[model samples]
Target: MGPTPSSSNDRSERRKRNAKTTIQSLEPDTLCMIFALLDFFDLVRCSAVCKYWNTIINKSKLLREFYAKQKQNSTEFSNKSTCSETSLKTYLEELAMEHHRVSLQEGLINIDQWKGHSVGFNQCRMKMGLILTGKGDKVMRLWSLESYKCVEEYAVPDTVPLVDFDFDESKIVGLVGTRICIWRRNGKRSIFPSNEGTFVKGLCMRYNDPEAVVGCEDGTARLFDMYSRKCSRIIRMRAGPVTCLCLSDDQLILSGSSLGSITVSGILSDQQVATLRSRITIGGIKTLCYNACSHLVFAGSTSGYTSCWDLRTMRSLWETRVSPNVVYSVQHLRSDKSTLVVGGIDGVLRTLDQNTGQVLASCVMEGNALSSSQNTYGATEKRKGRRLSEGTPIDSIPKSARPPITCLAVGMKKVVTAHNGRHIRLWKFNS
Candidate 1:
């Protein structure tokens, strides 16, 4: 009488079957897509859903590719590297605990203690017991880390506000605006460009040759011969301003640009052989570093992403976004342990293990009342126009803590972070 009771029961069974998602029924391509997005925990949950789903995942090439990348990240990059699942998982778990005991190990050349660098709108580097810093007035100061005293000072007559700088034992190279100035024990030399508007954005010293590859705002990279102090060769790319550059072990140059392109080319050759483009456009690549053993390029973008790319296959093995803001610095060491360290405009510092694309350590570069007081008067005043352009709410975060990390240097298990506020902090991690 109730409009057929059997009809209602049959309808209920049909609903039950429709409510369940059976992986076996989905097309192979669809199932693979679902598996691609599932991370470690999600994959474990999927395996428990049913045997058919588990079988599909185990047999798919996607799983194999994932494992291959995991293995590559854990071991030192070698053409002949292999790791078992147990080994990869064990290494990542250990790395995850590497930075748990992190603390403010030492404060070296900080704004609170040493007041030599007047304007503080520069960069800092720590090696051995020496601290290298660039400041206003076109000056570079080398200070003793232990004593926090300036042992040596070098100034380029009138180069105000160094955009970037680097050094080896013999010479210090400073990128002031768009010009490359080399400061050495003997004298200072500035490389003149033929193009009036040619500004050098970044530069990297080559390992095999006595040359420095400089990336310019005009989408050109030039190799400067250190001995002759002249531009040796020119490399042109169809991208935007060359923002960063790095040299691989085999002497290949990997350059990043503001237009979200990464170009690879040989210094001796004339053409850009390969280009890696970011699909999502994370504020364009701002920094580049290399891991020689793995032949992997670590690229940091203004959009807070730090990605690892494979040179041999020309494929991205893994990528990660480390912060909600811009990544200002990226670095990697050529050790068996695959650790990629990054710092950014958000003051977020992270150490990532290449093996699993997981974060090994994360901490913020905190500013003190001194850094706050100093930056309030100097750093902010210089870059007042662009401080609030990144969509970051500065007023809400407190003035003392909002200075973006400008640069970073690593040595002997220690990491040194230089901020826009003339603060330099060092941290130590135990193996």
Candidate 2:
């Protein structure tokens, strides 16, 4: 009953021919329609099915259009990717510039050394391309930062050295003995009270336009109106002799006394707002600075400790000893306040983290580069045979004597430090 082999073979061959009716047998148009319905990935997968399907997909007109569109889309995607990459690169570059840590990593480059004043500058302020420095001298000199030369000299009437001085573009104001002296840029000099008083001997002074605040020896801060030339108010600390003071635009006065007490009071208010309390007294505060943007007060003590207190919460933020001796100054740039620059009797310039009180960078005067510069300067002055008789002679100062940092001013990419000696050093940060 079984079928013959030839007959079975013929039946098998017929079945094979019937099975040839597949997707490959579809017309070019139909195949194109089907391929068009598929996404690019599916189309690519279908192309790999067999030779006939692949050839039709590749050669068909409609499918060729799809290929062209896909190519164009790929080109656009590539362009978009490149544009995005370029934009990201530019953004990163700007971010690097904005938060650059050049001073932290590279230390500081001592770019130039010069004499800042006729005497050792105890106070220094820099702004508008000029440096104003005074050592309680009879004259406070204005030195051009670009030229490194004294452009103008402001003289006080009396021979008594100024306690402190401040200047703007219009005029220079200082506390000379018991008198408040002011000199206009136009060569006009004026003294308030026009007389001396025992209670008015200023230890520190700060000037804002139309008003000046002086921390007096009598444990009070005296506010004087520059326009009216009269003492408008006196905020008494009653702690000890006021040694240092800071002024805010809104009439806030923070005065430090010799008895290690700091008081915050407003010129318009009668009572003290708050006293900045410190559990560990590090001698009296030698310098005080206020940052309006942060509502923070910075103080340096005679025993080399520098501290920060937040005025908003009336609490201490941080306190760290920057030197073994007196910390003469504490400052931070307005544009960047994450780091504090502390210079003191140790003759070291230190950059500290504002948040954690960590030492980020430090610079000393005894390096090889500094020694070379000193030697070169001395040799040049000797060759010229013109010794600067003003102040302490820079060439005559011994390299072994590392003078204390008396004052400092911070700028865009540079820091200027004045020592107890007459020399000043300009330190530049790598860009």
Candidate 3:
């Protein structure tokens, strides 16, 4: 009993009519609300579905309101200008060039070069700043960012080299071997004893609190009360070292490990709330960052990829292959959460869109070649090291080329990238 051709045609027409009627009856305000719930990438795809969707999305008032709300908490939209399309394009280009020129100076000597090697920046109270570096000097050097000069250099007793450093508004924290040191802004320094651990790999402070979290190479992440200098809680991992950690505004501690797993735990209860496994296996997780505005968590791998996960849903939002080499650092642009800057073993710095995983722009590092194993003194050492496949140099390659990037940090006005050649380049928007 097969249906006749006429009956089949009639059924098909009715289905089409029903769909059209449903779409036509949807209110513009309701459509706007629906779009708001979706991510930027999903919204873009929705707009292409039909003419009705396009009309709602193109409404100036709706788009303006959405962008304004995003700007309130995100730094990404702070620098955007509401000008004509052509004018906006021109402005962005000029801003990119300005950021590239001032921050990416090549073949020049740094005025305040120090002995030893790894360098980091810390925000200080009263508009002051600190820079920590290592070598045989065995000292932490504090610097003034306004004057671009060293203010104080505190010496450490032992010859143990600094493994990691972090700071907040009130104090500076440094980890040398297994011991953790806390120094107040007023110049008091004290070392806190920890159970036997080879290295402290990650450090982060809780938002709006004096408490901090530290991750070690022994697969354990612990929360420490900075005031009391006591371990408050500990979250253990399965295997591999805990490489990077970040604390959300709600006091949720997120940790990424070399075992290709990301775990989230509540600080107060010290309970494992959620966990996500990597889509692709890598050497280890190198860096992690959180964007509170979007509730997005980003994890970068030693294998050269960055993965984004939604904190609320505990599901992967998107993952993109950033570079061929290992990704060392990842930071969300304060002005725009949609934009993220990634530094990797491939000496080039890339800015990507969070929703679509599209690269916005890339800047290449042009300098002398340096070996990967070269540590503090830029000299080869025999210690255990992470390895990545070597890629072509930035200057000799095209704009789309990828090169290795060692470290990255975002500041109030600029984003800085540290290259293998002991080069630190800053990037900022021009307008």
Candidate 4:
């Protein structure tokens, strides 16, 4: 009998109580300093220790600034609330809880997939709960994001394939051959055709509400007024064919050419501002996107490199080879601009650090269907031609038949990837 049983139990309880107080006893500033050294996921885990830790982690301004790049004083947030200002912590909490069901840092799982088009899906865009997809068959289909059912379909002339398309809440616009095709969502009158611009053929387009900028095969960008259905201006890039276009609210137009040069021009001035040239001159620029918050512009090349340019100084920030072949798509999260996602011919999805161009994570698709428990979604119609591996093992499929990722769209915590085959994949990440 070294000690009575009751006495021993009391001693253990005292130790457990003291352990909780030990962390709470530290001054808030000291605790903040300790938490500052921890990474994002570590801090999230630490918050679950108790109420004290959770409150501190949520209230810390430093932590919010490190994780959430969104500005509290921005017009979108400030104009919304008339009584009180929205804090970064609240914004972060909303995004973490509502939007980001999974974390991209850890890894992604192929949870759901389906056949998106009869032919290959050439381009896609997602908004709200709807997805708009375009194919080389001159057909554009709109699908419900949740059901994976084709809600509506629009078609152009069979002779001309759909080049590129974009949609908002109101209407859908596409570059069909030499004209700008428009379809109003209300279905009052469909296919508002624009005046045929001087360009021979359109390669790509970006819509800025009432205005649409169409990049053409003639190395020229024609700005079209959507409301009036007229071509406003023709800005000459003088590079090869204009392959991609990015529009900014600051009245700047960035057009990437097949000749591997990106020309920045002002909308009002209608003159060339600057040119961004990548070190790899052989590959043409396939995609271009602008991040207004960071004043950064991203360009993906057919030569497998992705480059970033700072609009403030008009200088190249960083460039890194993301793929062995063409990088067809490049997109970043709206809430967090630090993580950049790239996909292309390699059939691999990669996440990169936008600031340094460092590869953070890579995920390869094998085209094997997961269990029904993992993914309940499947194509309603059977794929007509050569189907993706389906339940077949990766080792069985030939490397040459592997489908290239033609386009991709990021939504919340999930990523939807379209391929040269009929199938499209959905990947979800976990914290």
The RMSD of every model to the true structure, in order and in angstroms, is: 23.4, 25.9, 22.7, 14.1
lDDT of 3 by residue, 324-376 (tens): 76888888644345567788876666667777776666655333333334333
Candidate 4, poorest ten consecutive residues by summed lDDT: 381-390
Write down the TM-score of every candidate.
0.62, 0.69, 0.60, 0.72
What is the C-alpha lDDT profile of model 4 across 1-431, one tens digit per residue? Answer: 49999999999999988775666689988999999998765676577667888888768844555544345444444333443234545555555643352366563354565766667666778877788887765677788877777787777777766778898888888777677778777643244443444357888889989998988888888888877777878888666788889987799999988778889999888899998877656378899888887888998998899899898888888899877789999987665567778888876677778899987776654444434322233444211112222243434545543457788888766777778666666666655
Model 3 has how many clashing residue pairs? 15
**lDDT per prediction?**
0.62, 0.70, 0.59, 0.73
lDDT by residue (tens digit), candidate 2, 1-431: 99999999999999988885866577888887888788654565576567877787766633344444644653443443566446434543443334435643353354566655555666788887788876744667787776677788877666576778888889998777788888998878888765322346778888888888888777888888888888888788665788888876566788887667689887898579889977688788888887776677888999888888888888998888777778888877764557678888866677777666776766654333432223311311111101112243333444433468888887755677777666657666654
Ranking by TM-score: 4, 2, 1, 3
Off by over 4 Å in 2: 1-101, 104-108, 195-199, 366-401
* Model 4, residue pairs in steric clash: none
Residue 50 CA error for candidate 1 (Å)?
62
Model 1 segments more than 4 A misplaced? 1-116, 159-161, 186-209, 365-402
